[model samples]
Target chain A: MSMVSLTVNSRPLRADVEPRTNLADFLRDSHDLTGTHLGCEHGVCGACTVIVDGEPVRSCITYAVACENAQVTTIEGLNDDEVAGELRAAFTREHGLQCGYCTPGMIVSARDVVLRMPDASEHEIRVAMSGNLCRCTGYVGIVRAIRSVIVERKARGAAPRADLRTALGPVGSGHAGAFAGGADKTADAPPARIASPVSRAATPRETAKLDADFVPQTSFPQSFVVAHPVDVVWDFFGRVDEVAACLPGASLVGTPTPEHVEGQIRVKVGPMVAEFQGVADISRDDARHAGRISGSGRDTRSNSATRGLIGYTLTPVEDGRATRVDVSIGYTLTGMLAQFGRSGLVQDIAGRLVSAFVQNLEARLGQGEGAPAAPVVTELNAGSLVYSVIVSRLKELWRKIAG
Target chain B: MKPVRFDYERPVEIGAALALMQDEGRVVKIIAGGQSLGPMLNMRLVQPELLVDITAIPALKRIEDTGSDLIVGACVTHADFEDRRVPDVTAGALAGVARGIAYRAVRNRGTVGGSLTHADPSADWISILSAVGARVILRSASGVREVAVEDYMLGALAADLNPGELLEAVRIPKCSASARWGYFKSCRKTGEFAHAIGAVLVDPDRGVFRAVMGATETRPILVIDRAALFGASGFSTGAAEEVAQAAGMGDLLDRRTHAVALRRAFEQADAA
Candidate 1:
């Protein structure tokens, strides 16, 4: 049980209620504010809607303990509120309600729509009403009622109230960034950053966006110097069978086709290691001496996703046997790979990978006669790539922190 | 049905809330908006011994506008966001998504932190914010940590939040001029959960292009900048199905539904 105090319907109310008691039950059982009804008792039906600190909230879903030291308004409070009173009259005049089960929530929601969305369109009204399901009435009359309220409010030249509670004072203000004492491990750090609202333009496209499940596709460019002639290096990478072998943490599964190779690439970052089955569609343009390997795969166990568009162009150097290989890689990675795919970390790892591959290539090409020696660098494994890079990044960040 | 008997605590500050949740050594659940938890409570899906109400904590409700990132408090309601009372760097995309959550009543109480912490893969915040590269600030007894929104959800109703860790705020980057986005959600009708969700965000300047599919009832699957580099016309009907099958959706119906949703999303992005 919890001792709770809150201002309800312009009166101070105190109660010893169960911690899980919802605001709707608290209002109805203790204060007899049955006007704030309950329907589904979950969140779907808005029958138990009430204004907590001027915002319409589903009392059925809101806990009574959470409302301590706050202002609450039930349907009974509408008798005194000018905007709600006007809305009640409009609802009655337009037959906006049916069996009245959803009326309380509808009316509370209507007050919010009228007060906050002063210039709501018909579509906006429908959207606002969508959250509060009214099974009895088809919502045609409800829309009409809210629309009338909008028009009336607009004609009167009324601005929306900036504060949640018109009767009570505001609830809280900003605080010091740090906690009261140096009690926990976080005490050594600076205080939390302060949050103050910043004005934004009406156009949405120009502002900040927060979206879900939007894994962005990104491309990175890598350039490395190879210690061999452009033609020699180009020919070396031109062969499909040899080119696929250079990939880190890779093993070809079957006989290679002219344009296809099936393999698995393992990503091991310390304790986290994931193996993804990948199929690369190998292609090369003889005229341009450029290669493009477009491939995608997923690790079923980790539920991680990987897609890569790797294209390389070998340009001749001004002098000597050195050739500059420009690698432009575009990839979309989700789940595990994405977890470590920070830009700085990725770039550093990629640079090291190219360095390792080029060193291996230089070793194999050093053989003047017979087949090239098996140029295997054990640390070049993808697991080591992900692990070493992540560890180094963490160490670098830790260094900056210590500094 | 009412929830089983539980103790409750409402702390006015973040530190107090953290200490209570951590040091109390009892089964505690943090309730921000209560919109989602309320439904689960009635169905008896979960009942903790203590409910730590973080709504009154002033810090969690603050909206700080840094020059580049918009720091939104965890308790900022969808209604507050929908009404444009907070800073949105994603243009009006945040408000637009907020206005459509469940209902005006639900939005009024449902919060960004609660939504993200709840971690529904099909949730607009999970897909949209993750696509836009938002990070969630988590406060715990140890300290504060920031996690990319895209990497937060592990599976349905699963998140990376550790015990004693509470989601504090969300940091979103301001939309740049080159950013173009499209989101398509197919719900049975209004207010119902989505059947299939496709969200794409393209920013040529930052080299970010992603197409994400949600509402699969698990984790979201994404296709990177290829969607933007290739353009919408690049996807034939066969290509869309291939991309869906590649993501490894569990069932045939899901593959088809996700494919149609992704195509619609690409078409919308192209039109935009």
Candidate 2:
């Protein structure tokens, strides 16, 4: 019903499209760009891969309306690029594909890997291509094809590939930072200064060296500081029943105590109920002017080892009108629980647990009689900022490395 | 594979887009990146009466990063995030999940606000934004209202956004130097819908931590609390199960295949 003009693979074309018309559909249906296929119509399969403005994405899941004035490239567009040619040759020479159903996506995804990761390893190649599924080739040939390109490129004295290792550094690493100039103005700012000088350098070689020197072997402490007076906060945190009651799905399985208490707690997650028996260790730090509490327990029903520790430090600020609390925790997992673990899933569940605990603590502290009325300031330190930047960068680098 | 016969409108501004939506009502569906919605239409899954294309709206395409937060327009695509042209928080989060969203071409056309509004539990934005405590700004003829990511998603493909309301932008709180954040997803293959997604943001100094899990259900499951509890013995089975149960996340096996993933996330946060 409407006329729209857009560019595809550097060519401007006009089309009459419905509002619901997807760009991928337009290309395949109207423009005859069949190189981009459709699989998992819900946006999971990489069969419909394309390059728009130098980044690769799933064309199948993208709408034509969203790309009114954007540049787009299908597999057809790669006909002229040397990197694409090399990848094609490598795939053929290495037998990188089998059915070829996923070839277009494989090649497009590999193109990104090669461009971003000039110095990738075999392991890195596998990780990068992990996103694109090839049911037939068993990934052996695909990995070899990509690795061959990197090896050949390196042999020619080309720049090192942007492997996941280098991408894991701080925001300003040599390779990752190269693209920093292209980042939006907001993301271009320098990272906050942390107390420690943790190097944010890119490159697996550099990361390996840094890890060797500072592995962060020391576990997170079980004590922390709250922004309120130690005695006042202690009176609230010391009660086991109150702590259990404050938790969303926590139910005390035993008695309360002043110094230490042991209890069993049941948490219902979906259809399963996981229970843990834990003991709290409470103490005071006079030198640093803080209070601490540590709890350790395991899921007896699931027969999994799950441990937790909490520490708090309270600092009076603004003429005692408000208090600042520094809390730290260290947890561990072992036994049956260790087998099913992956990076992202663990982070999500852990993040939710922590958030719930904080909200509960805040609500409790806010409700108590005669509680101080002050803004609770949550500050991120320099060390943490550096870690976030490095972790984020590394994740990107990993994708390129895997591809 | 092309879309069925339907009307199309490309409004130069938001007002024109809104007027078209008002006239067409339920018959119209707005398109941004078309990353998710595009494929559905191609497959004939959704047939709308009218198509109100907003890609030409210049204001909706800008990504603004204020010191305290990052404001992403509705038309910002996944390609934009992959290009590192957005804030680190936005780019990093998108990059982590981009590889799994199909292929390079889809990313180029996918928009952040579009994904969030679509409210697909398996979609990347649902979990990432919820985990990061991002807010969605909804615009309607009546006015505008801001809803937290955690509250906006009511269920799978179900959101609090009304039919006439448009998702204008997403606001992500600026991360601090000391905050520790991580995002993870589990799927059968790369560029696949997540069987489970976990996102964590921890501020150790302030004793605050937020953990969100999406794709396990219709909406993202959020938990906000003190980070220290993760280190306690109670964290693994006690607090973990409690938090999971409260959020109606179901059983470990049903929601996520592995128990180790749950434990690892807890351990990582405890260490942070």
Candidate 3:
């Protein structure tokens, strides 16, 4: 056994824990903090919700020794907060409880939601509370209770007592009392009113501001500058063999056309190998007066389909020494990919593919000879001039060596 | 259900932690947040003879933002990333994924380095750190060595961390201003282990993108590109099918689910 010191809900606790003791077990079994329940012994269930340093997490899945010197908060600690009280009241008034097994976890989770999202909507609240499951099928009422608090708080310009009571119901209301039963019994004390208003539920504006703090922004315009004539760059880009060489783990097959290009692309990524037939539309961007490519294809291996549009604009820079290239791509998912919508995983894969393409192009261009040391300008170029020069030189050398 | 008996140590410093690890050798396990390892212990998946608790090592808890990179100690919990005091690039992604880690209690007890060391394929940090091109700092009796995040992850529940070595901190380069990044995961539920995860960063100005996909396998699948060929039909078809084949989705228990995940990954990559 080892002795470790830590703070739990503002109280200092010193306990002798075994090396294998989990933090959730220590809290529930040793300290008797039953407010933190165990749903999945694994990390899945949000049932064992507890605030560790202000963030909520599963207690059942945490090891006790890992929390040495940490500040921990269970459902017991939230009793003193006005927002928790309001959520409790709203839960009761809205009949957010049934058999009540999941209530403690729900309350702890709800406390986090209220603190983070005072003005959360019914849908946002539902999404935020999705981690906590209620077998009693009381999610509708639970959502209403949470949303009611938000509506009430927003109307009053502060934490409103009426909203809290209306959303949760008055203290001692049947449903509210039942959910509070375990907490009250564990504390062995009567519920007391909190005098501070500063601790009121976070309003919608506050939650929105908070949401804005973390939401990723998409602000960059997709554009690049290449130093070659538009015709030369376009010719190289139009060649399937040359394009294939510039793509990692890719091989191109078949012929090209003005409206569409058809071929087989064998691409290997990590442990997976995909062999698929692809077709794309090549067109002229009339508005931006650039080259526009758009089309859709399918992966025969997974039977997944992909669709996208790419716009490219080329401009002369420093004579014919360099050309600025701009590329923009808009892609959509269908078939199997649609299942992963809104999960955030799709965004990650898209980013990787784009990055790899860029790196491959850079490497391929770096290998070309007499690629201008300085930037160049060319009105007729399709790609970067320096890159085109290198490619052209390499082709010439290959031809001379073969001859 | 109580935990089985085992030896424990509270190391006051990094040297003490390393010394204890050296003495105990493989018999000892180092604990940080205890989020992932704790459940393993409770399940008896790992029964170490001695546990060296490095929480008392103050040096392992610091987050230093140097001009070029951000250095984070091993003992730094996900909550530490939520502190406004931390840098925006590090904090934003950390908080975003950390918030999805089970719930509040787990995040409280979980440490940043611990999750990476555990190398759970479904873990958020694995994919995120891998995509960002972070570096892991390891300390042993011999000295300290650094490994790139991509090189550190060996496989499922496997890492390049050697014996008698303890992870001290992680360093991540500051993202370029033109970088547009995104992270996505598919799980049975919001807080559950991810079925698949992808992390991506795109530099539109530089015409480059970097991506790492995790959970479909033990280590992350890395890809880099400049030509934006993925947006082309042929490349998209080839890449999507390739991902499916690489993941062995057809033989998977839930082939449909896996296929969906792979397709989504491809679409997401194109979108990014």
Highest-TM-score candidate: 1
TM-score, chain B only, every model? 0.92, 0.88, 0.86
Error of 2 at B112 (Å): 1.8
Model 3, runs deviating above 4 Å: A1-36, A53-57, A63-73, A159-403, B82-85, B90-98, B204-208, B226-235, B243-272
Predicted candidate 1 versus true structure: per-residue lDDT over A1-403, tens digit per residue:
4466778988989886766778888899987889988898878777888987767788887777666666788888888788888888888999888798888888888888888778899998887777788887788889998999899889988778667532111121111122122111233432222111121112121211212333338777887778888888888886565655565565666677868777666543322345666677768887787887777766644456677778898887869578898998776777634644544344444555675576567677776434766656534433233333335434543343233
**Candidate 1 wrong stretches, greater than 4 Å:** A152-403, B23-25, B227-232, B235-237, B267-272
State in Å the error of residue A361, model 1: 43
The DockQ assigned to candidate 3 is: 0.09
For candidate 1, lDDT tens digit of each residue in B67-181? Answer: 8889988988777777677755674667777777777777767788988888665677887787677899998878899988866664455577776788999998878777777
- Model 3, span B42-94: residue lDDT tens: 54444455666676676777778888788988877665554333456642555
Computed on C-alpha atoms, the DockQ of candidate 1 is 0.13
Better of 1 and 3 by DockQ: 1
Q: Which ranges in model 2 have alpha carbons more than 4 Å from their true place? A: A1-45, A57-70, A98-101, A130-135, A159-403, B24-26, B89-103, B205-207, B227-231, B249-252, B255-262, B270-272
